[model samples]
Target: MSELGIEYQTVLGLPPVEFVHLAADLDCHHISMKVTGGGIYHHPAFSMLDDTALRQQFIAALRDRDVTISLGEGFVVRPAYELRDEAAALDVMAELGVTRVNTVTMDPDLPRSFDQFAIFTEMASDRGMTTTMEFAKSLTVTDLPTALQAVAHVGRPDFALLVDTMHAARSGNGPDDLLMLEPEWVGYIQLSDDTLAQRNPVYRDDSSDRRVPGAGEMPLVEMIAALPPVPVIGVEAPMRSLLAADTPVSECARQAVAGAREVLQAADELRETRARGCHR
Candidate 1:
């Protein structure tokens, strides 16, 4: 009976107000916001975050619309200057009243130990926000080594890794991968679909590339079974078919929840099976 949510990207082209409206239409309880664009030196908000008043107004509007801030995105790991910018992004999260900040693991040009990430974690912790790092097959930390490095360096439960459906599948991470992660290192999980045919694509931003949870061939059910319990499930399907299809965003949101429902059920079954096996 875990709650389900979708990324703001799912309803692309919508501003924060419109995004919340779409979330309401879909019966979604949360929406994610991005913080990066232009360059690493730029703030995570793409200049929109510069206006503290405007950002507060948007945050209030989202609350008024009865939607929770599931997450804030667009974080990058990069050079020294970029690290400062990333820290600034965390500051914005604190001001916006968001509890979690999400970013990717690729070190665009700079490689820092998990200790460096831990620093951001402490900073966000001071502001009442948590830091969640996402791994992509395309990112440098697609394997277990990088994941371990991050968790050990941060040494905090709040600064954790993101279990992404596509990343788990494309990178061949499975039950063993789950065992490798300390429960404390798991902060958030993202659900998406990817097929064997779609597996090595160099690009992932295209709309045609995405499908609803069960609609595509991603092994989401297994991936979910392998993950530790977490607070949120963020559906991030950005298929052009969904965008161009003549359906309401609410319906798509429903579909996202439906997909997650199936995964949760499967995870429950997995636990039951494991329990039975242990007894035997």
Candidate 2:
């Protein structure tokens, strides 16, 4: 069974220390966070990159809670922003024991997109870190095919691909698409669910309007069974309704984890059944 972790998007506004506390309380040892901020979420005044005192306090939080930053967020490769510009942040993440970083390339030029992302992977590997590139319909690395192309272009040992359930469903990528990947090339598998009432791909809406893992229509069990031993399962559901109702981030996290545990348990059973079938 895979361990449970929280994607920062599920509780986007929480700062590093508070986020760590939440993760500990919920028994999630791994995390994907927006450390660079970059105006992506509610960034606190305390700096994870600068401000040594704050950084130390944040580190202490992680130590006390026994939680680790599984993946560093906000390494977005945009037309205006380059991955090279994030060297300082990369150094900080490495210091904080973050070995894997994640990004989405929004640049339109495929060649440039491929090159810049590969360069980002090189930079990460230089700092004793590995990196994962995420694909989304709203971004230039739109689907599984384009994602694999970028991965091939990069062709680095440390580079890996991140596949989120919502993107796969919305972009029409299925379990077979994942089978094409070599196990080592696959990185974190983010878990999320879409409304059975309406299933469509609208980046803005789907960005936050996601249901908990077992609450909706996604094939969470099959999706997990398709992968070859992923490092972690990230619960990335951000319920806008719950947030709007002033629900505590902790409550949302608890709900997400509960649903995720059920989904992952079912996935384990499915994998077992498949193995038995093959033997038969």
Candidate 3:
């Protein structure tokens, strides 16, 4: 399945511990965990504040399954919001052996946002973690060029960019835009899709309307091919429609991973065919 990983939001509402098991069962080698939810930073259930016993259990489970906590998704960095206890979060990450944290910016002041991100990136780097900035059209750092600029401004080796397939499409970023990015600036790529209908109401529906890769109209094959070689693929299709229909999280994850695999397979085959044609 191209060793594609699953983002936590794909199976949102599943507790962190259970999510690990599901990722393992799905044969996913990597899992993204969220320490914050519903605008509340560090929800106890998933936060570092989670019971020590439970945290240990989670560690054991991860070790048993050989799954890595690839990325931690959290926050909208801005001057107005108080930064959470990053020390505590870093402690949790250390325990889990996580090396990357995802940051999204909502602040309109570019200078302020860049300054904040630089500090955040430095903090994460001090703790042996890399900070990946995720850009959405709805956010201040909207699109690949802007995101890359911010990362470059930060000028830290630990700073990188996260490109989500759905967000890239929504932001009008095409394969050409992705191709322009240097491979080193890309931390990872999130894979998901959505319908044209969902595009107009992205803010309202993005959380739940994302479709499995290859199930919607996104140019997933081209997007995947354009990304850096061997980039970690994160499946983030959070189909609330299925969840509302009482679809089990496991089933949703299975379908999401399967869809992503199909697209990757097709992309690979197409690349091989083109290479052969060129040689002939």
Candidate 4:
């Protein structure tokens, strides 16, 4: 079974220290978070990269909880966003033992976008970190093929594709598409569920709100079963309704975990059944 981790968006706005503690409280061993620069939906407070005291505290929390970040996000490649500006932050995250960096491609120009991605990849690779790039409808790299193409353009073994389930569903891909993925190109998946009928008419906003795993129409089990051997799977079901209702973060996270566990267990069984059939 793949290790189940939580993404920063699983419970947004928590400070670094609190974030680690939450993971521990939930008995989750892995988490995805932005180690530095903040942007849309990112926590507004200064991260461990900026504050030495907070950094120490955050490290202590991770140590005490035996929790490590499964993925490091917050790298957005756009026309105006200088990828070089993230070098120091990258170094800090590497020092903290983070190995995988998640980047969003927003630049409309494919050549320029690939160039920026190459620069970012070089920086991340220099730090001994592997990188993954994901795309959304709102982003320039809008589909799985484009995202995969960008990774191909980078031409570094360390660069791979970050597949967000919601984005995959929204962008017209399916579990069958996942089966076609090159294992080498597969990074970890950000898992969630969504209806076939688009929830938000706006593409970007649609990803922000997702049903808990197994609770919606998303073919999560098939998707999970079809995935290559990924190092980690992040739970990223952020319910805007729950947040709007003043629901406790733990409750929301608990629901996501429960649903994810159920889905994963089912997927595992399906894999076994398939393997057995093949042997027959």
- Pick the winner on lDDT between candidates 2 and 3: 2
Against the true structure, candidate 1 reaches a TM-score of 0.82
Number of backbone clashes in candidate 3: 0
Native-to-model Cα distance after best TM-score fit, residue 221 in candidate 3, in Å: 0.6
Q: Which numbered prediction scores highest in lDDT against the true structure?
A: 4
lDDT of each: 0.67, 0.81, 0.78, 0.83
- Output the better candidate (1/3) by TM-score: 3
**What digit string (tens of lDDT, one per residue) describes model 4 on residues 189-223?**
88888786776778657766778899998888998
Off by over 4 Å in 4: 36-44
Stretches off by above 4 angstroms in model 3 are: 36-45, 82-84, 196-204, 275-280
Candidate 4: lDDT of 47?
67
lDDT of 2 at 49: 69
Best-fitting candidate, scored by TM-score: 4
- Write the residue-wise lDDT of candidate 1 on 1-280 in tens digits: 3467778666554556656777777677777876433222111333445766667777777778788877888766654534444666777766666799876656653246354566677777887888888776567576555776767767777888877777676667766667656678788888877574443346454323567787777767766777777777888775555545666555666676677678778877987798799999
